[model samples]
Target chain A: MTPEQFAARRQAGWAELESHLAQARRGALRSVPAADLQRFGVLYRHAASDLAIARRDFAGQPVTEYLNGLCGRAHPLIYRGRPVRPSALPRFYASGLPRAVRAAGPYVAASLALSVAGVLAGWLSVRLRPDLAATLIPDSLFDRMARGEVSGGIGDAPVAASLIIGNNVKVALLCFCGGVLLGIPTALTLLANGWVLGTLASSIHRDGIDYRFWAYIVPHGVIELSVIVLAGATGLMLGDAILRPGLLSRGDALIAVALRAVVLCVGVASLLVVAGLLEGFVSPSDLPTPAKYAIGAGSGVLLYSWLLLGGRTRRAAAPRLQLDAGG
Target chain B: MLPDLHEIRTADNVGIGYDPAGIGSRFLAFGVDTLVQGVVVIAALVVALALAPAGIAGTLAIALFLLVPLLVSVGYFAVAEALTAGRTPGKRALGLRVIRLDGGAPGLREALVRNIVRIIDLALGIGVVVMFFDRRSRRLGDLAAGTVVVREHRAPTAAAPPGLPPPILRTPDAGPAIDGVEHLGNAEWGALRTFLSRPGMAPDQRARLAAVIAERLCERLGLAPGAPERQWPPELLLERLYLQLLPRMAPAPPGHGMPV
Candidate 1:
C-alpha cells in the first residue's frame, strides 16, 4: 500500500479507538465497576496494536501499518485479563473516602478555622466604616460590583458563584494531582488559599459594612468554605499517600491515592456548585437570618452525613471522582 | 495434546501463586520506608554537623560518597520488591527469597552487580522498561546476578523423632591406636572424616567406606585393614589414614629435606 493509503487507514483506526475511549468514559460515569475497566484495557490493547502496525517500517516495502492499527493492538494489552477481585471494591471505596478524610483532617481544620476568622474579620472591617468597602475591594471590581456588572468578582452573583465553586474544585483537584509531585505543592496551595482568604476577610471587615457583607457572604460561604476544607483534606490525603505509601511503590501509591482523592474532590465540587447557586441568587441580606442559617447549617450536616456516616448505611455511595487541572 | 491429569493435579496443589500489586500500594511502602530511614540518617548527621560545624563540609562530602550509594541501593530494591512482592514491604515482609544462580546468600558484591545493571533495565528513559517485556519480571539487576525470586513455603508442623538414639562417646582405653591417630597429617584425615560424617548411612555402609580407605592406606603403608580397624576402631581410622599419608603428601621438614 502507498504511504498515503497507510496514513488514511491509520487515521481511521485512531478515530475508532477514540470512539471506543469515549464509550469507556461513558461506561465509567455509569459506574460499570470492573467491566468498564476491562473494556478500557481491551481498547488500549487495540490502540497499541494499531500503533505498532502503522509505525512498522522496513528498508524495502514499508512494514508498519496505520497508526490506529497500532493503537488497536496496544489497547488490549493495557487492560488484558484484569479481573476485578471482590476485595478491590471495598479497597477502592476505603481508599477514596476514609483515607482522604484522615489525611486532610488537620489541613482542613486549620484552613477552615482561618477562613472563618478571616470572614468574621472582613465583616468587622466593613462595619467599622462603610466607605472602607471602596478600599477593601479594588476600585474597578468595586465599581462593577456596585453596578452588578462584575465578571469575576463578588457582584456577578450567578457567574461569581459558579466561578467560586469552580476555583474551589480546581484547588481540590490540585491537591490530588500533586501526589505525583510528592504532595508538597498540594499542601502549599491549601495553606496559601487559606491565608489569602483570611487576609481578605480581615480587610473586608475593616471597611465597616458588617451586616451587608454577612448577608452577601454567609449563605455561600458555608458551602464554599466547606468545599475548600474538603479540598484541603484531599491534598493532605495525597501527601499521606506519598509520605506513607505503605507497601506500594512510589508510582503505584501516587496513582492509587490520586484516584481516591479525585473521587472526593468530585463530590465536594458537586456540593459547592449547589451552594454557589444559593449564594449567587439570594444575598444573605435578602433572607431572614434563620433561613440563611438553615441553608448553611443544613448543607454542612448533609455533607458530613454523606462523607462520614452515609457510607455505612447507604448501600452504594457514588464513588468520589476527579479530573485534574490539565485534563 | 490433551491436558494431562497429573499436570492438573500438580497445578491444583500449588494454589494461587503471586498476586501482583498495582503501583499505588508499592509507592506507599517505598515512601514510608524511605522517609523513616531518611529521617533517622538526617538526624544523626545533624548532630554530627552540630558537634563540629567545621566538619560539616567534609562530613557531607563523605556522606555523598559513601552514604548516598548505600541508601540508593537499599531504597531501589526495597521500593521495587515491596511494590511487587504480594504488595508487601519487600522480601522480608513477603516471606519470599531471592537467590543467586550458585545458591549463595546475597552479598555486597551481588547487590552491587544487580544494582549497577539496573541502568540497562531502565531502557532509554522509560522507567523499568526492561521489566515489562522480560518474562518472570526480572529487570537487568536480576539478570546480571543470575538470581531468581520465589515465594518460600511454610514450614511443615510435625512432632520430633521418637526412635532415634543419641550418639555415645567411645572410651579412649578401648583403643590405643585411635589415641595415636592424632599424629596424622591433615589431607588424608580430612577426606576420611568427610566420608564418614555424611548423613543417612547405615552402620554397615560406614564400615564399608572405612574399609576401602583402610585398604588403600594399607597398600601404601604395607598394613592390613584388620590392623588399622583392630588398633584404631572406626573413630580413629581416619587419624591413622592421615598419619600414613602425610609422609607421601608432604615433603620432609625443612632441615630433613633440601637446604632452604
Candidate 2:
C-alpha cells in the first residue's frame, strides 16, 4: 500500500480507539464479560501482530499473557474494539522487593559492623576515665542519668526494655524519611545516632552500670539494630534509583524508589513503635538478673526469627520469566 | 449435524511468536541488571562516606547527606506509579511496568496503598516464592500491591511478504459519519497510517481525520457532496467501502463505546 493509504487506515484505527477510550473514561463503557471463550481464545492464540495492530494500549507480551490468564481462555480479544477483559488486577508489590532486600544484605552487615566497632571504641575511651561521662554526656543530663532517672537508670531492666522500643521506632522513621534528600541525611542521621548509642553505652558502663551491658543489649539489640540498618539500606535504595534511573527517566526512577522507601519506612516504623512501647511500658522496673537475661535473649530470638520467617504467608508466587525454544 | 471438525478450525493460518531464551537467560539478565544497580549503589555510598568524618561526624554526614534522600526518592517511585504511569527503572528494564488492569496509569492513592503493602510481600520471606507458582509470576508484593510486571521487550519480527494486499479494515462505527464518500484517498490513508505508527497526536487533528478520509472516499466511491462540518465523513466513506469489496467487514457493534 502507498504511504497515504497506510496513513489513512492508521488514522481510522486510532480514531476508533480514542472514542472507545474516551467513552470508558466517562464511565459510558463497562468491562465485557468473559462469556465467549472461543472468540477471546482466538485473540490469545494469535496475539502477536494481530493484537498489536488492533490494540494501542497493549504494552508487551507479559500483558498479553496476563490478560489471557485472567480471561481464563486461550486469548483476550477486544470487545467493541476496546480492551474489555484484562488480566487480573495488576500486582503492585513486585516479588522482586525481597530480592532487592537480599541484594543489599552484605552492605547492611558492613554498615552495622562499622557501627559496632564505633561503639567499642567509644567504650574504651570511657574506660580510661569513668568520670568522662560528665564530659561527653551533658552535666544536667548526666546527673539525671547518673541517678537512674532516664528510662530506668542505665542498668534498670524495665528502663532498657522501654528504651529499646521507643528508640528503635524513632531511628526507623528517621532512616525512612531522611531519604527525601536522597539518602545523605538518613545515612548521617544513622551514623550520628549510632555514635551516640556507642558513647552512651560505654559511659554508662564506666559509671558502674554493670559490665552486663553486653547482656542488657544482646536481647533486643539484634532486632533494633537490624531495623535501623534496614532503614538505612532502604534509604540507599531510593538514592540509588535517583542517581541511576537506568531505563527509566530520572523522574520515573525517583518515584519508584520513593514508593519502595515508603513501604520500608512503614514497616520499620511499626517495629520502632512496638520497640518503644516495650521500653517505656515494659523495660523500666528492675527484674531478677536471670529474668532480665531471659527476657532480653528471648526478644532477640523472636524478632530476628520473625524477620526471617515472615514470608510463608498465603500470597501467590512471584513471577518468573522463562524462555523456551522457538516454534 | 456439524460438518467434519477438520473443516471448522485450521492451524495453518495461526501465527505464533515464541521466545527461546529459556529460564537461564532470563535469570542471567535479571542478575546482570541487579549487579549493575548494586555497583552504582555502592559507589554512591562510598562517595557519601568519604565526605563524612570517620567517627560520629562522618556517620552523621553520610546519613544527612546520603541516606535520607535515597529513601525519599524510593518513596517518590511509589507515588509516581500511583500518580503517573506505573513504572520504575528496574521495572522498565525488566521489560515490565505496572498499570491499572483496566487501563491508564494508577492514581496517587493507589500508589500509596500498593507501596504500603510491601510489608505483606515480606511475610515469612515466602513472598518471593509466590512467583514460582503464579501463572504470571506475581510475588506477594505484587499481590498485595495489586500490580503486575510484564516482559519489557520483544525480539524483532521477520519482514512481511512483498506484494500482499493491505489488510482490509472497516472504520470504527461509533464516530460521526461523513456523507458522499465511498473509499479512502491515497493521502488520507497515508496520513492515517502515519498517525497509527506514531504516538500522541492532538485531539482536534485526530477528530478531523475522518473528514479528510471522507473527502477521499467521495472521490473513490462517487458519492454525493456534503459539507465537511456535517457528521463524520470518514465513517460514511467506510460504510461505502464495506458495501463494495467486503460485505462481511462490518460486524455488529460490540457495544464497546464505553458504557452510558
Candidate 3:
C-alpha cells in the first residue's frame, strides 16, 4: 500500500491515542478517567503494531520516522511499572554505603592529600604575612579567634549540632558535586576548606591559644574533615571518568565511577553526622584538655579501624549491584 | 516475506520494543541543563555577594557563594527527575525522559543513580561521544544506572479491538484462470502464495519475478509466453495462479492494525 494510504488508515486512531497521551502528560495516567485508561492501553498497542509495520513494510519512508518518533515517546508511559517501596534508605546505610566507600578508597586518599595540601597552603599564606589573615578570615570571625573563642563562641549545643550537620553535609555534597565540573571545583573546594583551617591555626598560634584551638577542633575535626576529603575524592573519581576513562568510553566510565562516588557520599554523610555531634557537644564543652583529646583520639582510632578492617568480614565477592543505586 | 518479529516480552507478555531518543535531542537537553546550572551559579553568587555586608552573613555568604550552587545543581537534576516523572528542565524542554530498560517510569533511586552517573561518567563531553558506540544511544549514565532515554510520544496507539478487522487490508480479488493451476502440487502452490502475499519488493523486481514465474507456469501448462489471451500484468498472473490453485490458503493482508 502507498504511504499516504497507510497513514490515512491509521491517522484517526493515532489522533485519538495522541489526545489520551496528551491528557496523561498533563497528569499521571492513574489520574485519567477509568474509561480512557483502558482505551489508552489498547491504542498504545495498536500504535506499536503500526510502528512495526511502518518499519518493516515502509522502510525509509516518512511514516516510519513518524512511527519511530511516536513509539519512542509512548514506550515509557505504556510500560510504567509499580515503583518498589521507598524503604531502601536504612538498609543502604547499614551495609551498601560502607561497601561503596571502601571500593572508592583510592579516590578518598587523593581527596585527603588535596585537603592537606590546601591546609599547608593556608598556613604558609598566613605565616608569610600575618596581614593576609585580614582577607582570609572574616573580621568578626578573626576577632573571635584572636580573643581565644573559636568553637566556644557558638552557643547552644543541640542547635549548634544540627546547624553543623547541615553545614558540613552541604560542604561534602558540594565537594562531590564539584567533580561534575571536571574535578577542578572539587579540588578548589577542598583546598579552600583546608585554607580556612590553616588560617584558624595561625590565629591560635598568634593569640597563644593553641590549647583551646586543638581542644575545640580535635573532637570533631577528625571525622568532619575526613568525610569532606572523602567527598572530594568521590568528586575526583567522577571527574577522572571525564579526564581519563581508559578503555571504556567516557559514558561507561562515568556510570561506574558515579555509582561508586554516590555510594561514598552516603557513607560520608553518616560520618559527618557523627562529627557534627562532636562539634556541637564535645568541642565546646568545658571538659579538660586531656579528656577532650582522649575522646577525639579514641573516636578517630575506632572509626578508622572499622573502615579499614570492617569489610573483610563480609563476603569478598559482593556484587556491585548490592548498592543498587538504581533501586 | 514477513518481517522478523522482534518482540520485547515483558512479565505480562505485552511489550513493544522502543527506539532510543536520537542523540541530537539528548544533546540539546544537556545543553539546556548546563545553561540552567550556569544561571543558577550566577544568581547564587550575586545573592551571596549582596548579603555579604550583614554581620550574620559571614559564613552564610561563603555557604551561598561556594556551597549552595553545588547542591542546587545536583538537586536540580536529581530531585526534578526523581520526584517529577523522570524529567529535568532540559529533558522536559526537549521532550525526552529517563526510562527503565523495560520502558517504565524511572523511580527515585533510578533517577538518583542515573544523574549521579551523569555527573561522574558523562561529565565534560564524554556523553555525546559515547552515543555513537552504544546500541541504545545510551551514555555512560544510562548504562551505569540501567536506564535508557526515549523520546516522549504522547499518543497511545491502540491495538485492534476484538471482533473488528484491522484498519487496512489488501483487497482480495477473485482468482484468475484456474485451468492451469490444477497441474501444480500443493507445495508449489503454497510457495507461490507466500511469495505473492509478501510486500516491500521494488517494482522492477516484482515485475521481473512475475515475468519469470508466470513464464515458467505457462510453460508447465503448455501455454505460450506473452499470450494475448492471458491479458494481465506478470505479477498479477502469478498471484492469480496461486490464489486459484490454493483456495484454502488465505494470506494475511499487509495492514498493521490488528494481529490476525
Highest lDDT: which candidate?
3
Clashes of each: 79, 124, 14
Candidate 2 lDDT, tens digit per residue, B139-176? 53444334444433332111221112333345544234
Write model 2 residue lDDT over A53-129, tens digit each, in one string: 22232223233333222221111122211221224112211333333355567546755665666566656666676
Instruction: Please tell me which model should have the higher DockQ, number 1 or number 2.
Output: 2
**Candidate 3 Cα lDDT to native:** 0.67
True-structure RMSD, every candidate: 25.3, 19.0, 10.6
| Model with the higher lDDT, candidate 2 or 3 | 3
Which residue ranges in model 1 land beyond 4 Å of their true spot? A1-157, A204-209, A313-327, B1-260
Name the weakest run of 10 consecutive residues (lDDT summed) in model 3 chain A: A144-153
Highest DockQ model number: 3
Q: TM-score of model 1's chain A, to 2 decimals?
A: 0.55
lDDT of each prediction vs. the true structure? Answer: 0.46, 0.45, 0.67
Which portions of model 2 miss their true places by more than 4 Å?
A1-101, A117-135, A138-170, A207-219, A243-265, A306-327, B1-260
TM-score of each model, in listed order: 0.36, 0.39, 0.57
Tens digits of per-residue lDDT for model 1, B66-149: 334334433455334322322123443434444433222333333433443343334362225544664444454554444444
Model 3 stretches astray by more than 4 angstroms: A2-50, A59-70, A77-86, A136-163, A206-209, A314-327, B1-80, B83-85, B88-96, B99-110, B113-151, B156-260
Weakest lDDT window of 10 consecutive positions for candidate 2 chain A? A72-81
Give one digit per residue, the lDDT tens place, for model 3 in A102-212: 887788888888888988888888888897677875465565344334445444455566567777776776676666567888999998888888877875588666776
lDDT tens per residue, model 3, B187-232:
4553464456556778798778778777777777666555652667
